[model samples]
Target: MRILNTIESALSGFLFLLGIVISLYSVFMRYVLGASQSWATEVYTMLLVWAIFIGFSTALKEDKHIAIEFLYDKSGPTMKKVSQVIVFIIGIGFSLFIIWTGFNMVLTAYSQQIKTIDLGFPIWINYLIMPIAGILLFIRFCEKAYKYFVKHEEVTHGGDVEWKQ
Candidate 1:
């Protein structure tokens, strides 16, 4: 589990850095060189997508995702546990929905040979990030659920409140 978290974090960071580099190069080429590669926009868009989706997994692992903690804190431990369970279940459902929709979107793009406006690069390749990240997020949610219920541990929310998850 720890290994998975580390891998996700590293991958997210790498993708983010790659996106920044690509975007910087694109800007430099367009302004400094007075010209830009036709594929720069496509590449940057894909990189940004990958960074956001992969970063989601990292956020989940670190419990950095935003939540309204005021109410959860006021509740008792049992209520906190219940809230965590509900939240985890909802998160799993949402991830599954994203995976399903993303899969279909990618499939359609691949089937139609979708391409970028200027570069003609395969669009499905970019869309693939959605499902991959969805799966990662789903796994992370399941891991949290296991730790919450089976282990009966409380999740510390930095100093705000202890969530029984």
Candidate 2:
């Protein structure tokens, strides 16, 4: 899980940087050179989408996702613990839903022969990251659950926690 998180973070970072570079280059070409790179927009969009989806796992691993902590902060210890269990259940269910929907989307795209406008690659190539990232996210959530419930570790990856167990 550690290795998977590291790889996912690195890949997402690389993709984000590459997307930025591609967008900047396209801008330069269009405005300065009076000619745009036709494939740049599609490629940049694809890279950015992949980066965001892939980074979801890293964010989950690090506990960096945004949350509405107002009610949680007001909850008691037992309620807090129950909330954690509920959160884990929801996360797992959401991940599975994403995997199923994403798989269906990929199959539909493949069957329909959908292609990108500029690059002409199959649209599924861009969508392929969804299920992969969803699986990684599910793994991260499981790791969190194991650490909290089995290992009895506090699940705080450098986040502010106003409540105590």
What is the lDDT, from 0 to 100, of the residue 37 in candidate 2?
98
lDDT of each residue in 27-98, candidate 2, tens digit only? 999999999898999999999999999988888877789876787778887887898999999999999989
Q: Backbone clashes in each candidate structure, one number apiece? A: 1, 0
lDDT at residue 135 of model 2 (Cα atoms) = 92
Top of the candidates by TM-score: 2
Query: What is the model-wide C-alpha lDDT for candidate 2?
Result: 0.86
- What is the lDDT, from 0 to 100, of the residue 26 in candidate 1? 88
What is the C-alpha lDDT profile of model 1 across 70-151, one tens digit per residue? 9877999789778887899899999999899999999999999988898788989889988998899899889878877777
RMSD of 2: 2.3
